[model samples]
Target: MTAQDPNRVFKSGFVTIAGAPNAGKSTLLNRIVGQKVSIISSKPQTTRTRILGVCHRPGAQVVFYDTPGIFAAGDRFNAKIVGTALSAVAEADLLLAVVDAARPDPAAEELLAEKIAGRRLPVVIALNKVDLIAEKGALLAMIERWSDRRGCQAVVPVSALDGTQVEELVAALIAALPEGPPYFPEEALTDATERFIAAELIREKIFRLTGEEVPYASAVTVEAFKVSADGRKVSIAATIHLERDSQKGIVIGKGGAMLKRIGSEARREIEQMTGASVFLKLFVRVQKNWRKDAKAIERFGY
Candidate 1:
């Protein structure tokens, strides 16, 4: 049957977004969800886990999972991040291998082929950040190479930041989706809990404020999330853990200004996400090498 056949039942499936670091995978995912479920930052490997954001339309439910940008495994923490990203690839019913259309890296292409080679899962390539390229021919060449190398079902060029060709990419995802019952409620946008989103939002802000390895070596934990009986407010106590006291100070900023700014930005985003005025209480602590601590890594949801 045709993709738009009225006689066909609604389609549903898990679509995983996978690519190398700074490939715009998270950006594309945020656009697809029409909300910021996955955090994005200028830093590489901003996403550390698989976050499922559901997209329900009139005739389909596309459960999209945004994963950490897949990079070559390095240290303990990075290995876990790569592990989480690869697991999403294996679990997905449809895979969108995202790539940066402006700068096509050969390493990314090699890794994509290595991970997906011989897999039977339906694969589509999304050429993201096409707006960065001045010439359309260059974008076309990149798409052609990826499509030829990967045997993609469709190669959709999109600029996730500018909303260029995003809807077409979503349509491609929907067309590839398989027939199944909706895994989430119609109104449910994400499978993650409020605590998870809050922690991620805080981390995103931290990444924005800090430089160097601060974002990579840091983790946030929500000690308590309590809602007031008034149903209009949420109170949260959270801890931001760093590997060293020096890193802690960096996160806290000079005279507490940086930490205050980070908290304010995170609180605003959390309030929007939770639909409540959030009174976020943030504390910075030294985990004393948490990334290397296996137990601490597990607790951080790595």
Candidate 2:
């Protein structure tokens, strides 16, 4: 007699999580995938494009794409942001219209209603940050409003920080997913490469160090990345290109102390991630008008 296995093959699909700036979209993604694929900050509009975070379960692979927050189509940059978010919704097998449960906005609801007007895909409303709501009545009211407007497949209350209802959310997402082969290896956590993560780490450090225009106009690119085969040590050289010399001075700070602190913090994070000694070398370069330079944008993987 032949032995029969009880476990059946599971399905896979894509889930796109998108919302307005500072809505805790990235925080939820990092929690769901259990890694930092996207950078987080108190600053609004930190994410500029789609960042993929993969989750591997026993019989399924869920590739979650975290897109930039949805704002009104403004300038070229803002248009790019809106386009990326909407594109993810259009292409995804499912979408999670993540809303900040603590601070529900009517504008965000209107945006969601407009998107779901003619779409056939199932959208699971992730009412995130539910822990912040003190009154249960307010939470229910928010849920009822969204359900009435868009008729969500599921309106799940969750705290992405404390991880309440996240597993159930994952299960709901997987159940809605279409059948497919694994999109990525089980061991992979993100679609971003080491170099991209390194640059992001540096950018994140810059975000923490300086405020205002410097963070807005700056971009980091890894000029060189080298690692030993045994994984004992790593060498990375990156350039922080700015639009003007004044921004560069602010980044470097008085006596270069600010830059040094930034480097130390980034290197420490890199070391923890790679479990290797790190030799981080940073340079401040002037790339005037890089954000508007098409060639520079392409080179930076934007």
Candidate 3:
């Protein structure tokens, strides 16, 4: 075997994205990875688990961990989700704190500032959703506010939805990471399995189409996944767990029309993601206050 050249430099490390709910953290992860590694929706707390998105650059490999939004944990489940986000902060080589520039939340900003305080890791504040801010002064003020609050190493304004200044944000993050070999293969985009992604796609549709608390009380689990003989098609059977029977009825809707709509939208997305025909079967069941039950929450992989 030949000896490796000492002059060849590579930067690779984990970058955790943490922010308040609906702050565009997941959107940023998807945009930077050039794929939909994390589910995105307007509803808060849509992401309940840690999602890893790997970005392979010319001289760097960044494994981005998209965490649940940091917020006040009013219940056991909420606390678990917040704990997941905080744990991600502790494992990062660099921290990208995304903040909504258009509608800045002081409490959310303060929560992140406190978590990152006294940490040795480099922190970069991503002032996200800049496209929504029509006033240049407001955007500049937001940048300054976060800079003063977190004392981050860099503040890069970006709009993850429209790919505005996203490359610049990536450059900033890569610059902060230390040089090392790639942590993941170049072909790998995320650590999540196909089953998990399919389930998330279904949940995302529910969050998008449903109103009120039904979306928040819902969870999807892929119970069965099968591939056709030729591998040209995929079949998935998932169960959507609801906290109440009424919610189940809401998800099913009249004549099962709502469930069909959710299934059709999710199937289309899954097909696009897997590059194969997808037959998605969705079933709704009441779990009886599953969110409040620790056992049920663990069973659902929250």
Top candidate, metric lDDT: 3
**Candidate 3 residue pairs in backbone clash:** none
> How good is model 1 by TM-score?
0.96
Instruction: Give me the displacement of residue 115 in model 3, in angstroms.
Output: 1.7
Instruction: Give the TM-score of each candidate.
Output: 0.96, 0.91, 0.96
Residue-wise C-alpha lDDT for candidate 3, range 204-273, written one tens digit per residue:
9999999999999999999999989998899999999999889998999999999999999999999999
Expressed as tens digits, the lDDT of each residue in 44-123 for candidate 1 is 88999898888877778898888888878879888988989888899989899998878888887788778876677888
- Candidate 3 TM-score, true structure as reference: 0.96
Q: Judged by lDDT against the true structure, how good is candidate 2?
A: 0.83
Model 1 clashes, total count: 0
Off by over 4 Å in 2: 1-9
Itemize residue pairs with steric clashes in candidate 1.
Answer: none
Per-residue lDDT for 133 in model 3? 86
Off by over 4 Å in 1: 1-6
Clashes of each: 0, 0, 0
In terms of lDDT, the poorest run of 10 residues in model 2 is: 1-10
Whole-model Cα lDDT of every candidate shown, in order: 0.87, 0.83, 0.90
